[model samples]
Target chain A: MSFPPLLEDLIRSLKVLPGVGAKSAQRMAFSLLEGDRLGGQKLAKTLAKAVDGIQHCTSCRNYTQSELCDICANPRRELNGEICVVATPSDVAAIEQTGHFQGRYFVLMGLLSPLDGIGPDELGLDRLANLMATTEVKELILATNPTVEGEATAHYIAEIAQQHNVRVSRIAQGVPVGGELEMVDGKTLGHAFSGRKTL
Target chain B: MSFPPLLEDLIRSLKVLPGVGAKSAQRMAFSLLEGDRLGGQKLAKTLAKAVDGIQHCTSCRNYTQSELCDICANPRRELNGEICVVATPSDVAAIEQTGHFQGRYFVLMGLLSPLDGIGPDELGLDRLANLMATTEVKELILATNPTVEGEATAHYIAEIAQQHNVRVSRIAQGVPVGGELEMVDGKTLGHAFSGRKTL
Candidate 1:
């Protein structure tokens, strides 16, 4: 619709956020115009600040602002001969939330979907191998998600790690905790069945 | 959970989004990590640029990089003495999308909610009155939402507009275009009943 150009631009700007559809964008525009000018300003300011402030760690590919992201800079991170190879930074955060794993990470950037034009280079597999060759890494934790592409990428990375003489392991895939058997999707149940372990 | 301090900070940084809870933040963090470090960088860059580049229009209070937003700069908006007042910029967009109105707008910046400690001053109502006084504004369209606070704010503004010899009218409320009468909530029905037309 033809609005005074100012109003139209607000809706277009709100649409830039991820998962923000047209209706949600409209809501944000309304909120900003109505009285949440501060909120809108804050959001806009943060958006700019976060973009410029947060950068990928030169080593791990995690979000950071300075030369290295916070994780890469920490002394307590068990840089010990262990690195968790993951497909995304979000995966790293998920693993960290579990408060378990004590090591570093290598973000894959993408999977080796040759059909989709993504190759080993796009996934940064070469970079991971280079790091393994240079570092005294004893183990490589394969933490790629359980999707088809994720699994394929994990296997490919594992093979490379083996060639580099670094121990490789994959995160488990089975019935999730608190999972209802009846509600469990067939694919997940099938995966649970195939990956069954002896306790 | 003992995570690398940097990793922990990265997770903490993502929690500022509107609907993002801890779990969602964790998921986003993990996804970013698992994906390309470059992609994370790209997302960060985009966020920063949007925040820094956007500002609000001086006149309409809609987002803009300059003093006047696009609509306020336009020559053809609301020339016949109508000024639509809304709580948010999004409401302006909604009306524009319908392409129904032919007038300029004054975004209230927000509604006056006593419970929330919001009042007329916060909404810049005085500025609106000034605009009405100087401009050839005859009709003040109270296009605020139909919520209790929105309704109250409309009536309050209407009272002020009356003092200035301007006609004040409210947008209609009822079952939305795609809404089923059965599915329509009590509040909608009540507003419809109260604002029912005589045919």
Candidate 2:
């Protein structure tokens, strides 16, 4: 039996999802057209809404709809004299899930990759500097990954923090080569970041 | 550092992506905030464009940019006694990828799972029945998966075709139990659907 043209388009577009190639897209398309209309509608609606509604936290560069994120706005987090620097808010949640760190986070959003023309400005190093200058934060923990890029980024930030009389430390051993914060486990992250040696 | 409310909402909202949990959402938020304004803008644009531009093919229920899907519109697909039935257009593409199954397709979209309240209408069986009545199809191959529900659906279609005086057959064996069409190798699918046994 032959169908009209409208059905084929929906099946093809589903291929855009990660790990979903042509075959999987067909399954998803069939499943949606056959089973999950609400799921499909929700996927379409929320994808757009999330993209449009979300923006970077001005202070830490975390995604936020309002002025501050949940961790940044919490008054209890302010009492801690430290700010954990990371490459993403996902890093923040990874740390927070452990229930170990009392301090809030300052997400770097990205690393300083000079080769890629990404500098301190692009990585929001100036934001960290501004925060150190204004706030009473004592320890600045660099929780970026252990990649060459991450190490270079940590060192770059450490040099700048030293200027503001801030104690800087990077996460120590535990992260494997080419590992990302998202892949690292919570228990290991606490050990790595807490046992960080002087950069 | 404390962030604003809107910023938090943005980060939190991103957690809803297919695999993105709270932490991943935060990471994405931070990534955007830290740098990669270009990447962020591109991601936003991609998401927006995909959602708005992608539509279902009227014929096969697959993803398409226009009214008719590429396969349905192609003149080459309209050769004699042609019309392969599948659960999705992905199946059509899979069969096409093998350079076999020269006939066009009718995507069943899904099996009839009455336990889930999915009947013929839900699976588009009625449209398929109507299609077979008018089309000059010489053979109808049931290319649905080998699942219990899929078998049941195949049986129901067989009965419907008997009433319509159409020659229908199920795809042949060698497909693993509970295996979906997308999971099987290309050669296997070509062999299985082509060698389908008559019900």
Candidate 1: residue B184 Cα off by (Å): 6.0
Candidate 1 CAPRI grade: incorrect
Best by lDDT: 1
In the range B81-184, model 2's lDDT, one tens digit per residue, is 56666765556667777776776677765668778787888767777777678766677778788778878888888898888888888876667779998899
Candidate 2 wrong stretches, greater than 4 Å: A1-34, A68-80, A97-104, A112-118, A146-152, A169-199, B1-82, B95-104, B112-137, B145-156, B169-199
What are the Cα lDDT values of the candidates? 0.71, 0.68
**Model 1 spans > 4 angstroms off:** A1-16, A23-80, A94-104, A131-137, A164-166, A175-199, B1-17, B21-79, B96-100, B127-137, B161-165, B172-199
Per-residue alpha-carbon lDDT of model 2 for A90-184, expressed as tens digits? 57767887787888788776777878888888878888899999988979988888778988888888898999989988766666678998989
DockQ-based CAPRI category assigned to the predicted complex of candidate 2: incorrect
Task: Write the residue-wise lDDT of candidate 1 on A43-107 in tens digits.
Answer: 44444444446556778766666776666666566456678988766677678898787778888
In candidate 1, position B94 carries an lDDT of 75
